[model samples]
Structure formats: C-alpha cells, structure tokens
Target: MTLFRAFFTLSRAAQRQLAFGAILACLAALANFGLLFLSGWLLAGAACAGLAGLAAQQAFNMVLPATGVRFFAMMRILARYGERLVTHDGALRIIGQLRVACYGRIAPQAPAILHAQRGGDLLARFVTDTDTAGQYYTDVLIPFIRACVCGIFFIAITAIFSFHCAITLAVALLLCIVIAGAIKARCATLSDRLSATQSRIQSELADTITAIGESLSLGASFHQQSVIMQCQAELSATKRHLAALENGASSLIAFCATLTALCILFFAVKDFQAHLLTLPEVPMLVLGGLAAFDVMSPLPTAQKTLAQVHRAFDRLEDACFSNTTAKSTSNDKAFSDYSSLQFENICFRYSGQEQDIFHHATLCVKQGERVAITGPSGCGKSSLISMLFGFYPLQSGRILLGGSDVHTRTPEDLAQVISVAGQDFHLFNGTVRDNLLFANPASTEEDMVAALHTVQLTDFLATAPNGLDSFVGDEGLQLSGGQAKRLSIAQALLRKTPWIILDEPTEGLDATTEQHLLEQLIAARPDATLLCMTHRAAVLPFMTRVLRIQDDAFCPSEEKKP
Candidate 1:
C-alpha cells in the first residue's frame, strides 16, 4: 500500500473504535426514524378512531404504539449521546496515530528541511493538519457511511408498506448523493489550491514572529508588519471565496430536498385517495419518506469535510516527503576514542550558494588539546560545528574523528562520541535537572551533580531551594545568560564524550567571569579534546592554540597576551 493508504490501517485500535462508534450512529439514526414515523402513526390512528365512534375508540389499542414511541425516543437520545463520545474519542486516537507517523517520517529530514521553512509552517502540518484528518473520521467518513446505511435501511422499511413509494424515495436519495459527490470533488480541488497558500501564509507569519526581535533591532519591523498584514488580507479574501462556494452548494441541496419531499407527499396523497393506501398508514408513509430524506442531510457537510481531509493529507505528504532534504549516508561502524580530529581538504557550501564557505580547508586538534577558533561574524564558525555533527552533508572531503571518516558514520554513531554546545543552545522549557537529563538520560543524580560542578554551577545550585529541581522557565530565561550558558555546558559535560565543541562558550559574561568560565571548561574535561569557536582573544592563554578567521586562509592566530 502507499504511505497515505497505510495510515488508515496503521492503528487497529482506532479502527475498532471508529467501527463501534459508527454502529452506534446507525442505531441512533434508525431509532430517530422509528420515533418520528411511529409518533405520526399513533397520532393519525387516534384521530381516526375518535371520529369513528366511542366504541371504535375503545377497540383501538394505544398501549403498544405509545410504549414504542417512548422506547424509541429514549433510545434515540441515549444512542446519539454515546455515539458522539465514542466518535470523538476514536478521532483522538486517529490523531495520535498521525502524530506518531508524521514524527517518524519527518525526524530524519528535520535538520535539512527545518532550515528551509519557518517553524510555524511545520507546526501547521504537525498540529493543524492532524486535526483536519481526525475530523475526516468523525465529521466526513463516519457520517457519509452512516447516511448510506440509514438510507438503505430506511428504503427497505418503506418497501414493506409500498414498493412504489420505496422506489421514489430511493431515486431521490440517489440523485441527492450524486449532487453531493460532485460538490465534494469540486471542494477537494479548491481545498488543494487553498491549502498551499495557507501553509505559505502560516510559515511567513511564524517566521516573522520568531524574528520580531531581530526585525525590531534592525529597524525593519515596519516592513515585516506590512508583509504580515498583506498575507492576512489575502487569506481573508480566499476564505470569503470559499464561503461563497459552500453557500451555493448548500442552497442547491436544500432546493433538491424540498422538491423531493413535496413530490413524494403528492404521490402518497393520490394513492390514499384511490383507497390503495389506508388512512392510518398514509401518515406513517409520509413521515417515513421525510425521515428517509433526513439520511441525506449530512451529505453536504460530509463532502466538504472530506475535501478538507484530503487537503490536510496532501500538505502532510509535502512536509514529510518533500524533496528538500539531502540524501544521508549511513554507517554502522562503532566510533572509537581518538586523540585528535582532522578536517582534511574540506570543501563545503550551503545549498544553492554559488560560493564555497570552505575550499580546501584543513584543521587538526591534537589529543587533549585546547583550541580556540576566533573568526569574524558570519565566518562559518557554527557551520563547522553543524557539519561535524553531520547536520549537513559533506560537499567534498571528509572529517575524521578518532580515525573513522565522519561522512561514513551514522548520525547515531557520530552522536555517541561528539558532543557540542552551540551558540543558540536550546534549554527546552524545563528544570535544571531535566535539561541535564536530556544529555544523558541514563545518568543518575550523582552524575548530574558532578557534571554541574564541573561547569562551576554548584554554588548556584546550593543557593536555590529547588537546587537540581529548580525551574529554569522557558528557554532558561529565569537564569542569567551566563548561567544558562553554563547549564548547557553542564549538560554537555554529562555526556563525557572525548570531543567537546563549544560555539561561543563564554558569551554574555563579564571579563572576569568569561576567563573563569573558560578555566572551568578547560578543567572540566582535562583529558578530553576541546574546541572553542569564540571571539575572546583574552581567553587565548587558556588555550593550547588560537586560530583566527581570515580572508584567504584559516591559520594559527598570534595569541594576544591578556
């Protein structure tokens, strides 16, 4: 089966729940039909009996019809209530399946794809798209199926009273269904076109919001605001168009339904006048005929929802299976400890860039060496770190860590040995211990505390009432910049990898603290190979070597005496 088709059968639990809910819906609908038809029959029979005579009224038995009406009324209410609960729960289960499936499909492609799109765009696929697909089961798929089953049963029940009447109802139902199907096809086409624009608008808005600080700082906030307003206007205009189309479709269906009911009533009344239909049975047939048409009431909404579901599915497919992600190279070889890391004849550039960032570049750090990489802004300091971790595919040459080529290594294997603390270190809205635990989940409290001490955060931990349990707030904003940086370092320390790459490690600290933090990092892993990408020339004394970013070549720096 194709990937999308496989999604339907991925979770048996959801399927079973959906089936159970559908059964309840069918029962509820049938019960409603029974209530309306029987109530009409009872009322008509009593009126006729009373007009006949006192003796005829006494002979009429109202007990069975009255009890049946009450039974069906109660059953209808209870069954409908249960059906809603079951269907929604089942829809939630389907959402769970989509969440997991999408995660699995997008994970491997994240690094490459994430850089190309805004976070909000991806969030829509993961959050909003799943919601739409789940509604497919509850609002569209389930209702459409229920309508079919009820329609068939309704016609069969009517056939018992009169074959000609049943056929008339069947023809009306079939015609209405064809109309619904046509609306659905058109809706799906429109939705597909709209979904792409919606995703783009969502991405643009998210990107703008995320970069609001930068935009304000650069004095470009007005431009960004104007762009956002434009997008919103376009979206609103598109929505109005969709509403107009839906309104037109609804009116057409309503017209068809009213015409069908009147025609059926006319035929029934004529048959009754001819004595072919009994007086008491005539009301039941008319009511049943109307109830049978109720089966088509959900058709318009079902068609529209199905169109929405298809739109969501298409967007999710684009997000997960997009061609933007570069092909990955996988290796199963175990990473062995090495005294040095080698970047040999490396040539690299960002995707779609004409110029190479690193052309025949080479770098080597000996075992247990402390090397500080100093470069001008936008000199690819962080890019080097990202490439080392296999976040970006190698354009040419190879990086050898512990004698094994990194390009040939699986990301899992690479991760086991190389640990990095990036410039924009993410602290993942969590507690002090929780963030640390992310680095080495198997580590105990003792290991965690020791790692924290290695980064010189022990005193801060002792001062807090929560200590290791201290809440860091969102993005560790509760802590000072230096403290957050130290916490990230501590998390990396918890990993205990031989190679530790720190991108701007001592950023956001005073002169004295910067030196102190550098000392602590050097002391934290005395035997581990440490590489620092920073602009702090004052911290060079602490490093075995300093390399400066230059115009022509990346060569050894003239260490400035602090």
Candidate 2:
C-alpha cells in the first residue's frame, strides 16, 4: 500500500475518537477567535465612549460586559485544555491498537517469510514507526480540523462586514493550504528515504547488540562502533536538513499571512477615515483579519507532522501486510482421527535452484509407527520435514494427513495433530513453566512436572532455586544447550499430539544425555507416530523403520524392513 493510503486507513480505524477530538478542537478554535473579535469590539466601544465622555453608558450597551468577557476567556481556556487531552489520549489509543494489529498479521507467517526479514528492522517498526504514526491524529488531524473550521467561520463573519476583507482572507488561507501541500509533495521522496534508512540503522543496531559478545571475542568491536557512529551521524544530518526545509516553508507562509493582514488593516483604516466604515468597525476589522492568520499559523507544522506519520505508515504497511506470499490455506478440516501422514510423489526445490531437493519423494507413517530418517548433511532431510509441517510448499506433490491433503487444511487444524522440535529452539524470557506449558495454558502444575520427568529433566529441576518456576532468562540463557533442548522436548510432549517430528534434537547434548532422551522418548508414547531426523547411529535401535535419502530420492534402506 502507498504511504498516504496506509495512513488514511489507520486514521479511519480511529474515526470515532478522531471525530470527538475534531469537535472539541473546533469548539476551541471558535472560542479563541471569538475572544479576539470580542476584545476588538470592547476596545472600539471604549474608544468611542471615551471620545464622547460616555464610557459607562457605552460599556452597558456592549454585547459582552466585563463579566461576560471573563466568562468567555475561561471557556476558551477550558476548550483548549480539553482539545489537547482528547487528541493525545486518542492518538495513544490508536497507536496501541496498531501495534497489536501489526503483530497479529506477522504471527502466522511462514518461517521463510520471517527469516527473510531483519529482526532489527522489525523492532524499529514496532518502536519508532508506530509512535510516529500517532502524530497523524495528535499533530495533524486535530490542528488542521480546528484551523479549517476557525478560518471558514472568521471569513464568513468578515464577509458580512466587508467583502473585500473576506476575499483577501479567503485567498490567503487557500494559498497557505496550497503551499503546505506543495512542501509535503516535495518532501515525500525524502521522507520515504529517511524512513528506510531509519529502519536499516535500527536493524543494524539490534544485530550489533545481539552479537556484541561475539564481536568483542573476534576483535571487531571497533568496526561495529564505527558503523553505529556513521549511522547516527547520517540520521542526525538528514533530520537537520528536513527540519530546515520545513522551517523555511513555514516562514514563507507566515510572511505572506502577515502581509495580507496588514493590507486588510490599511483598507479598514482608509474606509473609516472616509466615513464609509463606522468607527466601531475599525478595530473589529483589524483583529478579525489577524485572527484568521493566527488560526493558520500552525498549518505548515501540521503538514510536516503528516509527512512523519505517512513515513511511519509506510514502514508499518511493509512489515504487516506486504508479505502475503507465504499465507497458508484457511480451510477447516478435522484432524481428530489422523491415522497417518503421507507424502505422495513429492518433488521440491528451493527458489532459484536448478536441482530438486526432493524428487518424487514418497513416504508414509501409519499410526503408532516410530520412523527414523537419517542422511548425510544437505540431503534434504530438514526440507522434507519442513514440507510435512506446511512450512514449505511442495513443487509438485501432495501431503496428506488422515487421507486429506494438508494444504486443504487450515494451519490451526494441522498444528493440532502435529508437533515439532527443531535444533534451534527458542525460549522466551519467563519462568521455566511458561516455556514448557506455552502451548497449553490450562495445563496444571502436575502436568508440567510429569512432562519434565518424562524428558529426564526432573533432576535438573530439583537443583534449581524455584524448580519449574525458575526464571530462564532471555532465550533460556540460564540453561545449557542440552537443558534447553530437553525443555523443548518437554514442551512438545506436553501437547501429546499424534505426530511428533524432532530434527537434530540431541545435537548439542552429551552422549549420556542423548541416550537418556532416546530412552525417554521410547517410553513416553510408544503408540504415537514418531519421525526423527538425526545422524547419530545411537538412536537407530529405537526406530521401527528407517527412511534414507539417496540420490535426491527417499527410498527404504535395505538395512531396515517396512
């Protein structure tokens, strides 16, 4: 989506809050301009009475007495305060919703889609861009609405008094709006470039932070620091240049407005001197014309704010909605009685590669079968599993679960019947219980302990300060690689799904730990179908069948029988 359309969509979602803010801003603007008109009238009346020596009688004849003026001033104060409060609160609320929406859109995307994106860039979008988008409501929408309302009202009132002043104010206001639009149009390309660079710098910083330890170990800290400094300098320069451009545009508009107001004052004074306009109308005309300019002084700043919000919208749109190429099917198919998963004549390859990773690879595992798939590195074993789990699309084949095509089933349906634990397991910063029971919120303490016990993690839990409630730190840094793998296994076992896929589950574990894990898997659910990919021959005895990838094809090895 274009940046403008994305911003409009985000604003449209908060239309009710925006409308309320707009109404309050309009009321505030009216009160503000009304005070100017009333003050001018009071001054004019006092001058006429002072010249005639009837000040008290003229004050009583005035539409707004001293008390009424005080009350109007207080009303204007309250309206301005309310407008600020409402606009800020509304902007915050919309930004909060947009963050959630952006996360929700990305949650279901395939691993390939996520792997292609930089983690740092995603973080930037969530933090800076979302915050910037909120300016649309607070800075641009409310102020622009108030200015337009006040300008139109002031023009109408002036026209009732003199068409010449009204015409001048109208033309000036139109010119101000047109000039603001031109400034925005010119800055659009620059704004987009700034946003992209911002995202890139943020992403790079995140990566640098994440790998700081490695960088220090490799003596690359100076290199990383130099890169960060360069990025910061570039960011500062771009911001300063943009600010200067916007300031220049605003100054030009303000100058034009000042000149126009002065011209109107000159005309009003000439007419009054010739007796064509009454004495009481002189101050009213000047102040009314000045009020029109006051209402429009901030229009250029509002336009600049809109440009920032538009850039933010562009970043958010690219992150959230632009990568739909990996969207899976949305059909609902029952997985309750899944007896087997079958890969029928499956042929697949990575994008831009000529050789097929899996050519007409056929495989099937019936209910309760413990199947082991072993092969050398780069034999498409992991790719085969990815295709089975609906992470990769088959080039020319069908994957069936319970006699139905996997692609025809919704992701939720497929997940219900299958569970996988790959080599790269992720653990969030939370209690150990949180990581173990992530898939099952309703799991009781007893269930958590049982899963841990089944995975041979009972002893490790006994030595911990808080047992299962111990904090694992970020990405389970508190645990060793083997401990993390065992935790992942416990999590998968907690689901107790019919089909379990474990890819290199014991890669980082000691021999004893690996052997213990294999024993536990055999004892936990012998009836559940198991598909494990590993190069360790120690796990072979537990498998009921062996499938090997040979010459880019999956075939039964003669070492095992079906």
- The best candidate by TM-score is 2
Error in Å for residue 515 of model 2: 2.2
Model 1 lDDT vs. the true structure? 0.80
Q: Give me the displacement of residue 460 in model 1, in angstroms.
A: 4.4
Candidate 1 total steric clashes: 0
What is the per-residue lDDT of model 1 for residues 1-562, given as tens digits with 9 covering 90 to 100?
A: 2435846776466777778899999999899899888988999999999999999999999999999999999999999999999999888877888889888778767576667777887998899998888797778877788888999998899888777778888888888788778777677776776676777778877888778789999999899878778877777877676676767766776777677667767777787888777788777877877777666777777888788887788878877787453455676556655767999878878888888888888888888888888888888888887777667766787888867777666566777887888887889887888999999999999998888777678888999879989989888879998899988988888898888888887788788777667777777678888888988777778878789866524788876733
Question: In candidate 2, how many clashes are counted?
Answer: 1
TM-score of each: 0.89, 0.93
Give the runs in model 2 whose Cα sits over 4 Å from its true position: 1-14, 54-63, 324-327, 558-562
RMSD of each: 3.2, 2.6
